[model samples]
Target: MIPSFRLFPDSASTVSGEVNGFFICMLILCSLMAIGIAALIIYSCLRYHRAHERAIGDQRRYNVPLEVTWTVVPFVLFVGMFVWGARMYFDIERPPDNAISMYVVGKQWMWKIQHPEGQREINTLHIPIGQPVKLTMTSEDVIHSFFVPAFRTKQDVLPGRYTTTWFEASKAGKYHLFCAEYCGTKHSGMIGWIYAMPRKDYQTWLTQGAAEGSMASMGEKYFHQFGCANCHHFNNQGRCPDLRNLYMRPVQISTGETIIADDNYLRESIYDPNAKIVYGFHANIMPNFTGVIQPEQVAEIIAYIKALGPQPGAQEPSNPGTAPSTYGAQKGLAGPGATSISGSEVQER
Candidate 1:
């Protein structure tokens, strides 16, 4: 059966209606202002034109009330618009605490998606309605944009770094997904569909697939497979720094600089170990795995690292000298043949 065409896409997300309303308000205001200016121009031309082609025109200064009205009214409207837009921008940028996390890897002309439950999809995404879904996306090649017109959400996926965006489906239906950026020759073909289903149906869909395991579980396997377990151990007895409770915490480098152990930091540490050395660790101890592993493997390893720690908001040690209670006072342990750094100097702050 043939489907009927519509001028605008369906509003299938929680924020789509708000976004549409704001857009329409702006459009109507601009259109009215344009029409008013055009009408004034036409009226002036007809009412005050030269009577005989040699008629002299009268010089007049602008009225204070008219000038003030135009200036103040636009300034107020513009400030209002700025405030409204900024509020919406922040609301969209910050995902809720309970959002379901999903990973997306964009490369060439296709999108690779992995759910937290380990189900993988290519060019197609299935999300549950009424629940917020947050996507942590990165590109394996050139830049690509993850855009969904119906949800009114778009974010650029860049190489070597992670970009995130979230949206909650309001309606259970299929929505169009597009790579808004001009990627390569097959950019036009880089299109997909988002299926928003009921929570029960979505859970059934997840169970239908033959899953390897959760993303974190898969990452743990990769962590061991890549020989990372040899040097970096969870028990703090390893020659290298401890991996326990390290995610999202500040790490001091050798150069006396502090940086967060975010996804990008983990990726860089794997691909290029020498880029940013941890404050206590020396370089050349960890081998560079630039061409050895794919981006998906790196993501999995990061997931495993994330799993080792308390997810984001756990209470950190108040005392700088005190180590995290997870591994219990072993924060500064350096076994035999370990590169030297005093355990006391590795501050959790």
Candidate 2:
């Protein structure tokens, strides 16, 4: 069982127990060192007291073994701690491939959250337990942070960019959420709750009176509205790189630097368009749509890109009340009357 002690937050995540246990061990080690040093000071003062005014203290200045023992012991302890922390950090940063994706938008005094099924919530988040959930967050205006003490996960939500973080809740319950950043006068009031429910209950909560469309569906519509297909056509020549299957792939930049095309890279390529120029592609062609769209809309665009990639299982339910859906087709992805250039099209050209 996980301990619910006052020294730290409740150990509720998979890594929380291991992390907190290491923390507790370090704390005990430090406390013991402090107490031992204090005791030595008192003992030395009493033993070399000036009660006999003419007593000369022993010149035992350099005990090589004692000095080496203290030095090597702390060094070994520190290296072990560093390795343990590094492994945990690796696990925390890279979410599992089967993890679900969610979006979060931070505003002045509220948080806007969106699930895959297009369920929307303000100042609250609902998630299913025993599954990994990755959250790609951004800010509307200033800087904001998503903090949950129970899950031991906190990531800063910044404007004009994407920050991704993930967590798998170990238990099912309601936990407190706070904006750890001090943005404005109402910073303290920017609080919410994370409800980790059972898987069956979570699916029921998703379909109950909520929108039926997925993020990919909304992103597909946005892709057509912004006229991105004009330059990014399948049989198109040397204008812009084909964006098919671009997520998580490494692209060589103009400066001979290879970087993973993750969420942040995709956001930058859409907003700035000139920051990291592709090695073979020319710059100054794609229009910068920074201020034209909102942060959450960019998230939808990203969702559409990810959906365009290889889908392992069945697709999520689309929005019911909308038009007849032609979703999930990799070819002519913009529906019936369009070119058929897809990721496969890039090779033929």
Candidate 3:
């Protein structure tokens, strides 16, 4: 088996098996019902055949017990099927709490993925096996879909809103990831891969990235390049809300609704900022950056924030360092004992 192909239990296959089970039950019922019907037809034909021609008004009879038996039995069987199927539906829709998150962005011609560690890929995804992987996806330009044929999971990716799908690979293998929806002229080429590596390998990969320099740093670099830090910060420094610990916190909206800053909520707030503006921020101040920011950048930012931790003052810079703290400088600040930023180029343009 290919390393990325899931040969074991996965969201797609698990849900598929449940559906197939229902279908198999239906097939069996249909077969039995067919046999009984044939038997009744044959019996009626033979039993009613008289030696001589019968009168025009031959007596006809209906058996209430037979009618009730057939009707009630089928109804009970159907109810049972409904309950079973509904249970599976609910289970598949809600992912486990500890599921690993990967942000997916679908454009007309490509699928971009970002791991929480900030590893970015186009048309490919790397995930650890035997773990629940939840994909929070959105479209850049038009409608698209994220599909993994091996796992049997598909969810539409719409513009101006976010959609999610989750799956767990039972075994590790390379799987085909396709944009199931007709997105554009290049839709057919909108394909990628999913690498279900061992948990150790996944951790190793993450460590490798961090050793090289965390994706958070890369995300911070991109944040400025992508113009996200401009509007999203407070007091014209950034237009939207402060990014310091936005996730999973209770955010009070200008509309007077308090919301948990979860993945879906954050996704919506980014793609459709006017939907729920923060209590102090104005709606529409956030220009729709739908197609501008790449999926990889989004992942890096989220990863960077996640890595920043959840302490009370974690969001803010540690301390004031020095004047002329140029952009893109890795040194934290010019404070005492802080690393110096000497030869770093500050690009204001």
Q: Quick one: best TM-score, which candidate? A: 1
TM-score of model number 1:
0.86
- How do all models score by TM-score? 0.86, 0.80, 0.67
Q: Worst 10-residue stretch by lDDT in candidate 1? A: 334-343
**Alpha carbon lDDT of each predicted model:** 0.81, 0.77, 0.66
Off by over 4 Å in 1: 1-3, 311-349
Steric collisions counted per model: 2, 2, 14
Candidate 3 lDDT over residue span 85-193, tens digit each: 7887766676665677778888879887777666767787878877888888877789998888777778899876667788887667788898889887888899988
Ranking by lDDT: 1, 2, 3
Q: With candidate 2 superimposed using the best TM-score fit, by how many Å does residue 164's alpha carbon deviate from the native?
A: 2.0
lDDT comparing candidate 2 with the true structure: 0.77
**Largest lDDT belongs to which candidate?**
1
lDDT of 3 at 186: 87
lDDT of 2 by residue, 1-349 (tens): 6766565666777777888887889889999999999999999898768767677877778989999999999999899989999998877766665678899999998999988778888999999999989898989889999999998888899987888789999899999999999889899999999999999999999889467577778877787799876787644363776676555545567887666567898889889999998777789999998887667778888887766654523332321111223222222222212122233323220
Candidate 3's C-alpha lDDT?
A: 0.66
Instruction: Using lDDT as the measure, name the better of candidate 2 and candidate 3.
Output: 2
Who is ahead in TM-score, 1 or 2? 1
lDDT of 2 at 215: 79
Per residue, candidate 1 scores C-alpha lDDT tens digits across 125-227 of: 9999999998989998999999999999999999988998999999999989999999999999999999999999999999998889988888888877989
In model 1, state the lDDT of residue 160.
82
